[model samples]
Target: MTLTRRDRLVVDARAIVALGGPLLGNNLSITGMAFADTVMAGQLGAVDLGGLAIGAASFNLFMFLGFGLLMATSPSVAHAFGANDARKVTAYARQSWWLVLGLAVLLFTGMRQADWFLPAIGISEDVLPVAVGYVHAISWGMPALLAYFSLRYTSEGLGRTKPIMFTGFLGLTVNVIGNWIFMYGKLGAPALGAVGCGVATAISLWLMFFALLLHVRTHRAYRPFDFFARIDPPNWPVLAELTRIGAPIAGSILAEGGLFVAAALMMGGMGAVTAAGHQIALNYAAFMFMVPLAISSATTIHVGHTLGRGDVAGARDVGWIGIGMCAIVMTISAIVILLCNDQIAALYTRDVPVRELAATLLLMAALFQFSDGVQVGAAGALRGFKDTTIPMALCVFSYWVVGFTFAYYFGVYRGEGPVLVWIGLNVGLTISAVLLVARYQLVTKTRLGAAVQRPI
Candidate 1:
């Protein structure tokens, strides 16, 4: 039965939401753990909070690098699944596990050496010890975290997100309870403060990894994929292909993430108040970003699946719909941020200066929400097409060349404060949004035109 255009649009929207809903929930749960860490650390004191902010920024740099590399599995698996090529899907998944192991080793080594370079980067004496401790504690979970990502992306590629949602919530629960026990010194444990948050996070990551592994092993949904049917050794060609695709993705994510981390480090140098305020604002913004991020992930899967079935037009439609949906949702999120800025800030800390500054930054955050949504959504769509190298260059130009330059000029050189730094973020996101959407348009048009010209 041929469906009308409107009917197809409705179906596309439904598919996006169905896949994205669980992903959104999962993303939020992950962010919720961060939120819990921030609030808990804030309760201890501004110093502890500041330490956590720096530590978390550093941790995320390595974590995002690993995540970006492993995420290549999603599109690869999705394409194979859509083509009904189960063997290829299993092959990609196995090679991804090997990639995860290598990333885990590298990340763990780097994390252990964080203290050596942190001071050179201007991490203050007050926060250095706590930050170092936090990194050391969290580094223990690198292997587990990488493994979880491998499984999660594999499932996402196969259009299975409910397990991700369930495991995420479970991790959040474990994180909160662990924080209660270790952060405050309950249950005969000494109060570890910010460092305890790292310990809690590490433990929670392991739990989540094991939970997902158990599910994948036992669930009927994954049985046909033969995920455990055979253990394959390192396949150099497959690994190289994944790296060719994933390296740019890692670089692109790092470019954007590094921008924020740079801002945080700069704020940290200013004072604990500034750092804490920046953390609060950034944390909330990240939480809100989860919605669009989930939609973006779903868009990537949808586009990949459609393309696998030789439907370029369908892929194009899915991409645009996803981008539009992200923009609309972020618009609503901006309004909420504007309306509840103060109340939201209050939830993080009682320090009047921190709260006030955070409230002001939330307004800036609100302003950039739309651009953030559009850029990330567009990036996701591009990932589905396995077109990442150009996007990586674009991100570096937008974020480092344009964004960081402005941030440094206004916030550091001029001492204009966090507001100006956030304005710089807006500039970067806006530029990225404009260019990425245009890139998507160009790529889709070129592909569609070629499809038309093909000899039939």
Candidate 2:
């Protein structure tokens, strides 16, 4: 019995939601940790808040690179699971552990060197020390965080998102409590200020990793795969395969995230007020971004599953559906941002200048929400088809070549201020949306057409 188009849409939408809902919860919990950090840091004054902004932006840029590389586990494992190739699924999971561990070491080493170059980036003397300490504090947990990503992406591929969500909430709880203790000098601890936030976040990451590890090890649903039953030695071929797929993903993430981090770094020279304001606006925008990001993850899974089952047409449809949903959701988010930008800014700090500047930047954030949503959605869909190289190029060109160049020229050289910087953001995101969506259309058509021509 052929399902009507409406029926198909309904079924696919339900599946996307069923998968995305828990992922959404997880993503929100993850974002909540950062929100807690920002609000708490704001209370300490502009210098502390400004320091955190630069430190976090730098840390997150690197962190996302690691996460992006490990993300390949999702599609790879999803494909195997969809085809009922349980052995292949387990194999991929085990091999990913090795890859993540190596990345953890490299990232940890890199993070520890923040002191060496942060001042070179124009971070003010007062802010530089704070930023470097915060980064170094957080660097301690890199191993645990990367290990958790290896397990998290494996679970995501298996469509077991509840555990991930649960762990995320647990981490958020731990983070808040830890922040209270460390930042306030409670329980015989000296006040650490912004550095305290780093300590708490790092501790939470370790706890989250262990909690997820225990759950994955003991859960009956994961028993068949026996992920921990036997330790598999490093498999170079498997590592290479994951790397091939993930390297482009890492590049794409870095390109886009790098632009934002660069903007923050650039703001450093303007003064603490501007830096703090930018952080508030950027933080809120990032928190809102998790919605479409979670949906994009689900879309990748659904499309990968459809393709694995040899339903090329279904995969294409799933991609488009996900992209449309993201656009609609972000449109609503933009409305909310516009209507409450002042109130939202108030949530971060009480300083009048910071509040006013933040509210202004929120306007720009609202302007780009739709483009941000659409581009991420399209990128997610393309990953499902394992067509990452071209998307990487598109992102780099859009984010760095078009986005960064315009931002530096108009906002810095022209001395136009943060609004123009955000205009550059909007311009880049819009181009990325256009290019990536076009790429998706082309890839789906070519792949689907080829599939149709194959002999029975």
Most accurate candidate by lDDT: 1
Candidate 1 lDDT, 20-79, residue by residue in tens: 999999999999999999999999888899989999999999998999999899999998
Return the lDDT, model 1, position 379: 94
Instruction: Name the lDDT value of residue 210 in candidate 1.
Output: 100
How much is the lDDT of residue 28 in candidate 2?
Answer: 96
Q: Number of clashing residue pairs in every model?
A: 0, 0
* Prediction RMSDs, each to the true structure: 0.9, 0.9
Per-residue alpha-carbon lDDT of candidate 2 for residues 1-456, written as tens digits (9 for 90 to 100): 999977998898888898899899989998999899999999999999999999998899889889989999999998888888889899999999988888988999999889997987778777887799899999998889999999998998888888889999999999999989988899998899998989999999999999999999988999989898898998888888899999999999998999999999888778899999999999999999999999999999998888889999888999999999999999999999999999999999999999999999999999999999999999999998988889999999999899999999999999998889989989999999999999999999999899989999
Indicate the residue-level lDDT of 34 in model 1.
Answer: 97
State the displacement of the C-alpha of residue 385, model 1, in Å, after optimal TM-score superposition. 0.9
TM-scores, in order shown? Answer: 0.99, 0.99
What residue runs in model 2 are displaced by over 4 Å at the alpha carbon? none
Q: List the residue pairs that clash in candidate 2.
A: none
